[model samples]
Target: MQNTDAKVIDVALKYGYQSVDAFSVAFKRMHGIPPAEAKKQGLKLTFYCRLHFALKIEGVDRMDYTIIEREPFTVVGIRRTTPYGGGTWAIVKSNGNNVTAEKFFGRFYDLGLCFGFGQDGSNDYMCAVEYDGETIEGFDSFTYPAAKWMKFEAKGSVTENVLGSVWQRINNEFLPQSKYKKSDLPTIEKYVSWDEAADICNVEIWIPAILK
Candidate 1:
């Protein structure tokens, strides 16, 4: 058996955790007990191994997407910087007065804009809309450069959590095995729902990429 503290530290470093405290918080959230406590109590611990994406005929599923080159555009809205996996989205969404795309930009189009900039979820999340070169008071603005994007459409019974799952699949399963590399640009989530109470709606996720 490995030493508990040593094992925790090693795992933390391997996973790019800043400190043991941060690692412990995430560990407890996932495993239902602190690492040290689990070690001391001699409780069984579950380990999640890394997943590898493979291109197989059986694994192939129809993923609807289209490639398009978009021109430079500016987005204006509220921005929040939060730690990865720290319930940042929950906090932002709960405080709907500050973070809202439709309210700020007005319901002109079905597409509501969101931009995520950062790796490992430790980054700025912006709920914004395309600005027509007009300034909005008390809002942050980000100008995106022209680039080729792979846009994936999600429709029917869409929710915030469901969109997140789609993003995970795109990153882990689709992108890894595809003939494309992610570019150094922010990912976009466009909400295309006009009816708030509707069971089905359309949404699009755009990821910047270059052919490899």
Candidate 2:
């Protein structure tokens, strides 16, 4: 584990925080897993942090890991079979649509959460299914370009409250104040443990971002 990513709980507790739930969400969003699970999996965490902006406060904990580069891969999965909205309901429904794809390939990617592209703030967009490099019926493979990405780990319910709040913070607070700019790469959520999301879930959010 690199010293760059430190545990976040320490800071939260220092600031008189009592709710592990909230602290866990903030920690995972920054590190990619709960403090307990991160220790269990021995996953290193690393990312650039700006302290002047309070992007992180003192006593704020982080994971210890190096920021390593990763190559891009192609994923293929079924398109939406129904008129799915672009909200939590739509994303979850389209991802979990187990038609013939699951049986043929054991299990396509776990019911990962997804968001569709839109012109503005509209839900009338096309949702997608993710493939873990495995082929399935009615699924076409699409490749996302490889680029330096800003990744964060998070856990908890895929509820609109949690995710929506995070998105709002990133778009409204974080990006605008930081020297980095948001890229066009689509947002994604990869859940390593769906069942234990509340307590300990492995959530990785990747966004293509470049420094100004």
Steric overlap count per candidate = 0, 14
Task: Report the Cα lDDT for residue 128, model 2.
Answer: 39
Error of 1 at 205 (Å): 0.5
Clashes of 1: 0
Candidate 1 residue lDDT tens string, 78-194: 566767532434554576733355566664323233345357666566666678856877777788888878788666664455666667778777787666677877677777762
Residues 1-212 of candidate 2: C-alpha lDDT, one tens digit per residue: 22225555565576676876787777678777775565333356643434443564632233232222446766554334334344543443556654444565566354332445445544422223454555555654556676655555665565534445556555655567555565665555555665535644555665656666
Best by lDDT: 1
Clashing pairs in 1: none
In candidate 2, what residue range of length 10 has the lowest lDDT sum? Answer: 59-68
lDDT of 1: 0.64
Error of 1 at 175 (Å): 1.3
Prediction 1 TM-score vs. true: 0.57
Compared to the true structure, candidate 2 yields what TM-score? 0.52
Alpha-carbon lDDT, every model: 0.64, 0.51
**Model 1 ranges with Cα > 4 A deviation:** 1-57, 84-104, 108-121, 159-161, 194-199
